[model samples]
Target chain A: MIKFEVDNVSVEAKEGDTILGALRRNGVNVPTLCHMEDLAPTGACRICVVEVDGMRGLVPACSYPVAEGMKIKSRSPRVIEARRTVTQLLLANHPDDCLYCSRSGNCELQTIATELGVRQRLYRGQRATRKLDVSSPSVVRDPEKCILCGRCVRMCEEVQGVSAIDFIGRGSSTVIGTAFDRGLNVSSCINCGQCIVVCPTGALTERSHVDEVIAALADPDKYVVVQHAPAISVTIAEEFGVKPGTDADGRLVAALRRAGFDKVFDTSFSADLTIMEEGSELISRIRNNGVLPMITSCSPGWIKYVETFYPQLLPNVSTCKSPQQMLGALIKSFFAQTQGIAPEKIVSVSIMPCTAKKFEAQRPEFAPNGLPDVDYVLTTREAARLLRTCGINMERLEPDNADTPFGERSSAGKIFGAGGGVMEAAIRSAHFLLTGKELSEPKLTALRGTKDRKEMQLDIDGLKVGVAVVSGLGNARTLMNEIAAGRSDIHFIEVMACPGGCVGGGGQPIGLDRESVKERMKTLYNIDRDDALRVSHKNANVQRLYREFLGEPLGHRSHELLHTHYGKRDVLR
Target chain B: MTTTVDSILAEYAGAGRDALIPILQRVQEREGYLSTDAIVRIGEKLDLPAAKIYGVATFYNQFRFQPRGKNHIMICRGTACHVKGSAKVLENISHRTGVEPGRTSRDGQFSIEVVACMGACALAPAVNVNGHFYPKVSPTKVDRLIQDCRDEETN
Candidate 1:
């Protein structure tokens, strides 16, 4: 530890800590627009400039390292003026339609400008030409609002390991775009939308399907049915002013019902269904001398990334549809048939904690005919907006249960919201299918954390199975290389493109740091622990679905509706 | 099998990620611009993403995506040349040549590329045509410059 002076108060800081780190630790808050806690500080925004003794000019506090006995003023008059100037310059070229912007109150730029008291734009010049790129299904790019902070760029390249978009032009005309300035669909972008969350301005945002969903809800003929992903119920509390770590499961169901959803279901039901199919697939592959290290195929972003970057691994990925797609197919096929509603009239809308689910829903194969299995995919944020529009305060609603038949889910399915939850869920079900007995403690505690990669081996009735769970595409890439080199010992792997699985999905509440993601993850596990049925195989509704309509786990009807194939794609295209 | 691009890529076959900039530089030098095919090939050989390669290539002004014309006109618009009415000269050239800065004519006979400085401050308005230098050029000289390029293409 070293001693330093911040605002004339002697403060002790860790050795080799930066001024920004020390100041933040000491509760002397300095404004920063370009800083993400997980990313390396590049000091691109220059909003955190501070005065340091012996330095000729104000230094960027984010990247400037502290020394022993260093004198630093976080917000001296000169420092405040410099920060104000930076904010003013950024605001001068920005669009004046803050009231109408989608990210009005949540924008980091607006927050910093308000903090610095920069009410007036100091430098006015030629603003960047306004161009909207709405080519990608998940994310929208409004280039005119870009402040060139490089947060999106860094997030995509460093965290996701998909260098799909970057700075394309030079100087005043510099633009961040995909290769050759082509549409993101044609580029290597997987529509992950991590870039959308990190953007300080409204430059990148999720494409809105709220109006269309509302229209569907209003349509008399359309039976608008909604299903919430396992992660959505855990993370929706943030938008309702509830505590971050609180679970909004019952409230979300109650609110969705009030918002005109004909019937509300949990995706965890199909998550349990997915476990049955995926677990059976894994066992057959192992027993039948099939593909080893069968990778999970639930996260659509990870699926697209593998398709673009590592297509050869497609054969190793499980063939089961994601719970969202599975539930959509079931809602349109099985649920529609049982309810006596035409599949066409059933507008299958899914409230997902994922942006890639939007792209996945739009996939050609998911819809064999003109009508798709799922009509619209709304993010957790969009669903919250829909609830607010109908004046349904989720926090105020009484806790309720999801509708029956497709509503019941196991604790094993609920845990699918977080990283390694799928693998943990699969291990429990696979153990029962393989040996006809449960593991002493069902929860694979080793694979429970929010780490990028978690690996553990379990001896299930004399059959030793090695499983690896990876979240965040960057870590997935590292594991992919190992598997590509034929050096992997893992028999099964679960991959979620987002950092902490669906709990940290790109379509979840925006601007959520990893700390909040961990808290949201706890909600999933807490539900898993308290639930009566803790195993997927024990979900009575899932068993009833199989017994009534679907004959077996990997039977003929299950294969037709619950399974799919993948084709290779050229990344350059 | 022995195409110029193939040979260019073969030289960089084993060179890793750091070779991206140099590979792009040489490819652009030889091909006059960085084609999508070339960029994709470079990415494949270097084991890097095409978007990342394009990102680095675009950071440098020397790289171009469009093909250069037969007559590459290099106009200096540095401090010394701009003060000597190079803007008007540039306007005249653009009007006569019927092309914007950093673009080739429709017929592919001529192209205009503006440079910061050509290290010819003594001339104060030097315009380099291919390798030949024309100093102290004015708007009146624009017609002759186009005519000369057209005559050379015809002859």
Candidate 2:
């Protein structure tokens, strides 16, 4: 341990700890902009500068290591001036449209400015002139608002392994741009929007369809129906200040109803439906000498990653559409038929904990007769905004339940929100599909945490099935490389592009009561455990739908509606 | 025509991420400037994204996107030249060529470039035209220089 003095208070820190870490541990808060929890500190943003005794200049507390007998003043007048000046310099180049900006209240840069008492501009310069990039269906990039902290660049390259964007120039003329400075749709961007979630300013945001959704809601001719993703309920609380991981399904439904949705349902119902189709597909593949390892196709970001990086694995991907797409397809086809309404008259919308779902909905295959399965996709944040815009207090509203038919879902479907949830859900259903018997009391506990690549062997009716669950594209790339080299004997691989499945999705609340994936996982798991039905096959509504309409899993009707094909793209454009 | 990028990429095969900069340098050297085709081909060869290759290639000041002209013009903007009003000389040349720095003329006859220095401090405000050097240049001198280049080209 090393001893240090922070604001004249004697403090001891572990050896090799940065001064910021030491001070933060000792209850002395310091401002930081370019630093994230687990990322390597670049000190690109000088907002964390602090005074050190016997030092010539103030050092970045985030990157500077604490030395023995060091005297650190994180809130000294000199340090405060330096930090304020840094923010002032950043503000000089930033756009002056904060009042109309989406992140006006929540932006980290704005918060810091308020704390630093930056009431007026101290410096003036020519702000960077940049065109807004709305090329990607999910993320919008406003380069003029970027402070060039390099967080998104590092997150994309170092964390996600996409390396889609980077610092392209030098000095004051530098700009963050894609390869060749082209639009993002043509680039390798997966539309994950993790960059948007991490951006401290309004430089990045989900391409919102809130206005279109609002217009649809106000359209008297349009019978607007909405569905929330499996992860949305657990994360809505995080966005609404009602404690992180609170299952706000009731309030969420009430808000959606108040917001003028004709029907508000759960996507988990279709997740259960997905399991029926995917489970049957996995069984048929295993029995009929099909592909060895079938990768799950739930996360659209992962789908795009595999399509761009490893096109050869396209065949190995299951032919099932995501639960969101499946539900969208059902609402338009089956629900429309039963309600005696035309598909076009019913405007299908889905609230997802993902930005990539917007891109997925826009996929050409999902649209029949040029009408998209899900007409408009809204992020959870957008849903909250809509609630506010409609004058619905989501917090004070009484809890409610989802609508009929598409409302009922199995616990297995609810677990699909977390990292290993899909694999476990599939395993239970797949085991049942194969042996016509359930796996004992405890589930596949091995595939339940935030581990990078979890591999486990299952003895299911004399067949050794190897399944691997991996989150984050970086780890997925490693597992994919292993599979390519013939070093992996995995039978089923589940990949979520974001770090912790849809619970840690890119379109979740930005810097608002952010909770650990483990905590989020607990909410999903509790929902599953507390429910009466545990397996997808036990969804009575789904069973009846199969009995009445679909006939059976992997049937002709199922293939036409539930399953979809994927082709390798030379370029996304 | 030069050898295909396939052959150039074969030299840096299996180099992966580390080879990106060197391969970009080599591609720029061979192609005169980094082309979209070259960037995409290198991305395919190294299993890296095309945007990533472009990103790394752009960080350094050495890379250029536009092809160079038949005759390249370098205007020194070092401390010595700046002290002697090289900025005025640059503006004069740019106006005469009808192209800004880092751009080629429409006729593809002349390209202008700005350099930090030409390492000729003794001859302040120096300009390097193609292979030859001009010292103590002025706005009128820049106009004469362009006229002289055009005259030589016509002959």
Candidate 3:
């Protein structure tokens, strides 16, 4: 650590840490938008300008390094003026429609506008006009709201390892976009929604299906069934001002019930069903000389990344749709038939911690029946929006259990919401199924945690099964590169596009640090531990669904509804 | 000599929509006023093709895509360059070159372009004459910078 004194404050910081980091460590709030903690500092915002004693002019604190004995005035009149002018220049081109934008109260641009005291636009003749890019299924782009901070670019390239978009041209004419300004749906976007999470303005937003959800609820002839993803239980509390990582599963079910869904189910139950199918598929592949490195397909982002960048690896990806999609397919097919409702009258809804699920639902092939498998997808954020619109205080809602027949799930099912969670959950059932004996404990510590990348090998029935788990697209790139280089000997791989899986999804609450994302992921594991049935095979709901409805894993019925295929894409220009 | 707007538009749209950037760069690279039609036609191809393209084209100080005189002069307006009296340097360049930024000499011999944050902070008050980095430039050095470029053009 390097010790430095700035403005008589002695601070210790890492060698590569910027002056902004040092100051922030010492409780100094440096104004910045381009300096997110998870991303590398671009110094583009110019909002963290500071006055140094000997320096000729103000320097951006985020990019400038702190030298020893450097005296700095963080909030001088000159510094304030420079910062305010920079903010004003940014606001001059920014759209003034803050009140009606989705991110209104929680927007970083709004916070900056309040901080800078920008009352009105100074340069009004003609601001740069850009057409709204709403071609993507999951995310929308309003270039008018873009400040050219390159946060989305950095998030896509540096974090997600998918450089599908970049800044073209120079200076004021510079704009961030996909290659040839192609529609994102046509581009190689994985639909992870991390870009929306990092975006400061209304430029990037999730595609909403509120009207469809409302239509489902209003249809007296329809039976609306909702399933909440694993991570949603932990994060829904934050929307109600509860502490981060709070487990409000009971409250979430109650809130969904109050929101007027006919049945509030658990995706964890479907997650168990996924394990039964996926686990057996893995074992069969090993036995029958099928694909060796079978990759998990829970994350739409990872799946698209493979399709776009590594099309040859398509064979490695699991043929199964994610648990949420599986539930949607199940609800529309077997559940609908069993419950005496027509497939058209069964409106399936999924509460996911991801924005990519929006795009997943829109796939033409995803509709098993004449109607789409999932009628609508409500993100964790949208669910909270619905609850708030209904005037229901999430914190005050009475605790209630998930609807029966589809509600019961195991601890293994619950853990699938996080990184490495599926591998751990699958092992619990697979080990029992293969060995005909239960393990002392189901916690696969080797596969757990929020590490960027991890590898482990386990001995099951004298067979050494090598596995690798990766969270974050950058890490996924490293693993893929290693595979490309012929160094990857792992039998199975699990990849989540977000840094820590769905707990840190693009649709989750913004402003969570790595530590906070880990905390939320831990809550998922804790929920798993508290459950009596920790193995997927033990879930009675899953067993009954298989016996009465689907017949069996990899069966004709299962293949029709639960499995999916991938196609290659020309994402890069 | 006068150039038609059609040729410039065709050249800007020749490669791709993003081709306008290098086209404008080439225009500024070649003759030295951004043809307004070049900007308009480039916008037309991009679909967002708006008049604001002109505003942004003019906003940043570094664009000049037109025919200039025999000699073209550029002065650095970067932050460190600004601190070392680049505004005064601009005044002196205007005095010597008989042209301000985005302007050409009445005799059609010299054009001027000013830029921001040229990445040469260590050498404050920097300038590039005919694609050569001239660091630590001052008002006194302006006359020589112009004369050297003019001398090269004549030679």
lDDT of 2 at B19: 83
TM-score of each: 0.96, 0.94, 0.79
lDDT of 3 by residue, A259-308 (tens): 89999999998899899989988988888989868899988878778887
Candidate 2 all-Cα RMSD:
2.5
Error of 3 at A285 (Å): 0.5
Tens-digit per-residue lDDT, A428-507, candidate 2: 99888888888885367788776667888999989889999999899899999999999656899999998888888899
Could you tell me the lDDT of residue A58 within candidate 3?
Answer: 85
Worst 10 residues of 3 chain A by lDDT: A117-126
Candidate 3 pairs with clashing backbones: B32-B66, B33-B65, B33-B66, B34-B65, B43-B49, B69-B108, B69-B109, B70-B109, B71-B109, B81-B125
lDDT of 3 at A408: 95
- What TM-score would candidate 1 get against the native? 0.96
Instruction: Find the 10 residues in a row with the least total lDDT in model 1 chain B.
Output: B1-10
DockQ numbers for every candidate? 0.65, 0.56, 0.03
- The reply for model 2, stretches above 4 Å from the true place, is A512-515, B1-22, B43-49, B92-100, B105-110, B119-124, B128-137, B140-155
DockQ of 3: 0.03
Question: How high is the DockQ of candidate 1?
Answer: 0.65
